[model samples]
Target: MLRKKTLEILTLREGSWAIESAADDLEIAQKAALQFLGKPGVMGVRVLKESVGDIGNPAPGDILFEKLRSTGGADRIAVGEPSSLAPVCEDIEDLFHGGGRTTVNRLFRAYLDKNTVTATEVMHNAREMKRIMDFESMLPSAISKVAQMQSRSEDSPTMGERQNTLFGFADRLNKRAKQAESLDLPSLANVEINEAIHQINKKSNGEAPGYLFRVAASRELINVRNWWGKFAMSVDWAGACKSDPALANLDWFISDALSNASVLQDLLGDQDSLADALISLIEIADGVRSIDTEKAQDATSTEATAAKINGLFKASKLPESKLAVMERVCRQLQGSGALTKDGAEEPKVFREMLLRLIPGTELTGGPEMAEAITHRQSHIINKGGEGGLKAATASVLPALRDPGRKAGYLLSLIESDLGKDLLKDEIEQHLNGLFMTPESVHQIVRTGAPNKKMEKITSIFYRIQKSNLPDSRKAQLTQHLDELLASYVVDGKILDRLDDPNKPLHIRAFMLVSMCQPEMLPDGKASKLAREIIVKHLRRPNFETELVAQVPDEAKKEKILRDFHVQLHRSGFFN
Candidate 1:
């Protein structure tokens, strides 16, 4: 009905000149046609078609009213006969813009007695504002005006696309909010709610994600408020964006997000404990999530390259004075020795930082740690002697402290432990931070004095081997077993002991047959260690042999050698 009336005014306003009794018709037209004559734009006020306001008139209603004045555009075309267009357009401009002169006078009188923004008024006003904004965005003229108002962007060529997407999102969100409001909701909403579970779940293996993780720790409902108690104890934020606040913030995010504490606390069924403490962390993680992961990953990779660049620095062709100055700079770069060193562009400077990161895996007793030192570090070319040397110097601190992260840190160099040792206090501090105690965080299997590594391994292995010598030799045999277990596989001699069961489970059980083969132990100890040589493997939940069989090899063969070894040992082949 409203649209039809608008049409009548627009047509009669444009064609009214054809009417009989021109002066008298114009007088009647002027009075009734005020509805559509205002600003000249698609959505701005103008005589549209006709007016429902017209009564007993020869033609359709004389005016179409809008709240806004006609801006020169589509609405202007609606006002073509300027003689008829001028005054009516001028006077009724407020109709399109809420002058409310037409139907508003009735409500304005009601509000005149009670002027406060009562509940009804608030709801009505909110609806009005929302509709106004939406109406403006819907109009081509208004959209163009808004686009012009925006700072001319480098991406201006794609302005239409951007505007379309942005406006489309706004439109969808507006509709969604309206639907959700009618369905019983609160003033606040989880704006980021995922619609996948509600729509695409059957077609895709996806789950709807919660929009917000409560900030403070609250023992709220069981299914909600669960992300607390997750402290990121130990992190080598060496490759982080530390300078930018976001770097530290993201570090906190990663630590807390990945922390077993967060999930475990939830699983334990009481997340109401100290969970509020995680709010800031959650917010930061949310921000990190807002960014593209690919970009974040690239930044992390850049930092890794930076660390490597430091390791590659050496005395090389640079002058000696420059070298001395570089060393001073490297020391200056360290921050309480928490990170490797500062960004080093010079070879001499970077070399000092690089040396400190040498593979320190041997610092721990675990099989994976040792293997990591071998495989991971081996690939790092020790080009930057200065950085490596400086890192070697600082290695004493962390080496003495946890030996593990230090070792983990060093493993990037593909070199053996260089006797890096942290003091007791330092060890306690570092260990506590990494969410483990000295008792739980075992010392890294490392030796700085490389010359003595062979002697110690031989001694430990021989001592272990001597204890199990078969009767009188039983002691010797026990000793031999220990020797073989600890004994660095030097000349493939350890190949004979692959099936030793009495040895420590972590040692014997973790060994790979391919590891000790003379042909495979290229570095004299071992090369290309087992596929899964990271110490964290033990921390994971366990599964059975058939499950392990699922990991197909490169040629699609599942290497069941681990199964074979376990079976051989079970069958008492060693005995």
Candidate 2:
């Protein structure tokens, strides 16, 4: 309803007759003035009006009575709009009749009739002012205006005042925007927010202006997000917006606000801020049923948000400066709320990311931390076939030093067939460093070698001789075997004990065969000489018949000789 004021018309006739009545417009005041025209000695009259409530500036008491005091008395009251009044009023007759000749006593008495602002009036006025502001409609424009201020010249004389004005406006707008149980404000997409902040920085040119603008922009973003949070919780936004025109922007506001996660991350790139940004993105991810299903996203919104976050995880080049933030990001990604029920695939992606990340980062313990260990084990074992065995061993040995994460790694080593067969030597080599006692080491050795000490030695020799040992392992084992073989000979000849006729022929043959192992000899002359001895002495007709005659069956004798020939061929003796 339109509010009204009382106009007091004073006529300078018949000892100053006064007429006061309620009116909202000048027409009513003019009509009231005409009432005094017919009164006796009414040469001229003046009219002034005042609202009953505090309607704000241009008070009636100031305009009318101040003019009255300046002009002594007016021939006529200038006709004008209704005026806001002070809260207090005095008696009407006292101003005209009193000797003190106070300024507002007569006017207040004539216009307000000694009334003052009551509590009910004050409440009404406050509500009325609020209705006028319509924060839901004004806040968006205020935010845009604040953004525009960033482009203004910082050297302007009024820049400080402008900053003050913008800040004050933001403060009031923030308070008013949140007045409702829920709130409504502008819908700003993440890209738009990012661009706004970027523009502010660009325009500021890396000076104080840029810093100031960023401060303002950060504040504005916070307000926008806070309002978004309240509004999103207040209603089924899509449903309400469909039926109510007033809520049409609610859906836009929600979609845009939730999508600001990337922009928020960019704005506040510190560890705490990154932590906050990650949590927000998780909440958004959890809230959204699916980008592919419930809410499709555009370049500036939800899909963009998810992309930025995932990209953060995938980025391989993390400098020392960014490690803190990355750590926080990992912590948040591992939280229970980070993934939805159907989002099992997220953990796999997270695990892959953890593999790239864990080498540089030390985990504190969480699902992602656990997943990281699993990934590290897989990385070691699955990298580049047998070619990568050394690298895999190099990788696993260090992680196995940490007792807490060691169990899974040790189990991976023990349980895998390739790990057991191919990595057996490498693993056992680390068992001492892995905190096993001598007895435990003996047990693992017994279980693994299982009275196959000779077999294991033979296998190592076979690998060394065939040059099948990885180049790295071959160099060490070959040198050790050469030194070991030298110990058995005197002056580079077979030991005299074996050469003595006191030794049995088969025993001498076996001893000579041990010395004939190509792996036990050095590569050049020694290996050629060892092969010569094996072919000349060990493969002789007498030696073969003596060795084979021990086998009972004639068929077994022939089979054993053929197997012996195959072994010689494999040892490269035939070639």
- Most TM-score-accurate candidate: 1
lDDT of 1 by residue, 1-575 (tens): 44322232232233232221112243243322331222123232223333243432434334333233333363322211111011111222222111112122122222211221111121223342254333321233333333333325564535454345434433443443343223221111222112212222233223111111111010111122223312111112212222332222223222222222323232223223222222212222222212233533563342333222222222111122122222222222331221213323223333333343332323221222222222222223232334444433344334334333343433222222221222223323432343232211112234443223333333333332322112553243323333332344433344336435455333443454335322222222232232223222333456233324444463332335455455435433344
Question: TM-score for all predictions?
Answer: 0.22, 0.21
Please give the CA lDDT of all the candidate structures.
Answer: 0.29, 0.37
TM-score of 2: 0.21
Best by lDDT: 2
lDDT of 2 by residue, 1-575 (tens): 97555555555544443443434566555534443332334544455555344322335562342111112244322211111111111222221111111222212222111122111111113342243223222222222233234335565334334334433443343343234213222233333433444454455433333223323322333343243232232222232222232222232222223222333353233433322355444333323212332232454344443443333223421121133233345445434343333444443444444343333212322223333333333443455555465455556545433332333343334334444466667655653343333222222223333223223333333444443335665555545544333432433355455445576454554554454454334443334544555556665668877766556789977876786666566556666
For candidate 2, the lDDT comes to: 0.37
lDDT of 1: 0.29
Cα error of candidate 2 at position 471, Å: 5.8
CA deviation > 4 Å runs, candidate 1: 1-159, 185-510, 513-575
